[model samples]
Target: MYDGAIIMESLRVGTSLEAFPLILRRLSRYAVKTASADQPPVWTEFVFEVADEHAVELADALAEVLDQPGWYADFHNDEENFVIYPGRVFRYRRGDQLARAEAQEHGRTLGVPEPQLDWTD
Candidate 1:
């Protein structure tokens, strides 16, 4: 079985809250939550489990939202990670970060290395 998650980060600036319901409606299949407890209630995080087949759909929905001004979102699975920002979505594999600036310019996901688990050593 494959597992994945989608995490969206939106600033608390102007009318950003207005996009919440639209996003929830679009991604109704996934579980949703706010980051109020962990954050200062200024940010919200929606999380949900997804199968391998649903990854594309999740990315598309996130891409739509990210296309709008002032919104940022991301999706990650065992295979890859995506960063969605205004007007574009960046795609890259976990632990990869070649051409980050170029990716950002082309509206593509940058390659960022996954955080190493120091405890594993």
Candidate 2:
């Protein structure tokens, strides 16, 4: 097994049907694979990478949260940020500043409580 963490970003956002494919695409570089949901609402396999023991601890915490039905987790490097939604990306530094600006300019609606900044942090 490799050393990494997974993040399932949301639990009951929008709908699982629309989110899984996008999640797969974003993390494809890490070789993500899917499995049957076995439970209702379809769940897909999510895998990613982290560097050390602390990351491993973080990964375990993420897994615990994801164990609930309809959720998943995949962690990426700290330097790398995540685009939680279409046209909406977030990083550790600015939070949702850039994405919010674009949303305002285009009059686009954005999902709130941005997912990129983990509540645990």
Candidate 3:
């Protein structure tokens, strides 16, 4: 099932952050297995990066969001370095169009394919 299902369940019951991890754990029970090496379970984490030039502001913003439960790291390979859960990943982008553009640039630099963009008429 998609993460939306888990989120919706949480929202319906008014879950708190303290309780979010437990909900995530329960959701993991229903996760479908992939062909990855070990078929890791699903959990959530926040992935982020900032240019060395903007490190300070990025650090401050990261600090502000750290209270939320999720792993944080700068390097993509380092993500697999820690296993609080399995098959968990989240990418964070600073708000606004400029930030979105920069994220696309960074993704390209990392050899990640650009995501398809859609606009509703």
Across 73-118, the per-residue lDDT of candidate 1 in tens digits comes to 5556666766555446566775665634444444323222122001
Per-candidate Cα lDDT values, in order, are 0.42, 0.34, 0.28
Q: After superposition, how far is residue 4 of candidate 3 from its true place, in Å?
A: 8.4
User: What are the per-model C-alpha RMSD values against the true structure?
Assistant: 9.2, 13.3, 13.8
Worst 10 residues of 3 by lDDT: 78-87
What is the C-alpha lDDT profile of model 3 across 12-112, one tens digit per residue? 12323231222232323344232123222443333233234443333333333332222222322221111111122223332345544544454334333
Q: What would the per-residue lDDT of candidate 2 be over residues 1-121, giving only the tens digit for each residue?
A: 2223343443444423221212222342222233223223332334444344344444333433433332333334444332233322232323456643543332223322223223221
Ranking of all predicted structures according to TM-score, beginning with the best and ending with the worst: 1, 2, 3
Q: By TM-score, who's the top model here?
A: 1
> What are the models' TM-scores?
0.47, 0.25, 0.24
Candidate 3 clashing pairs?
none
Error of 2 at 99 (Å): 45
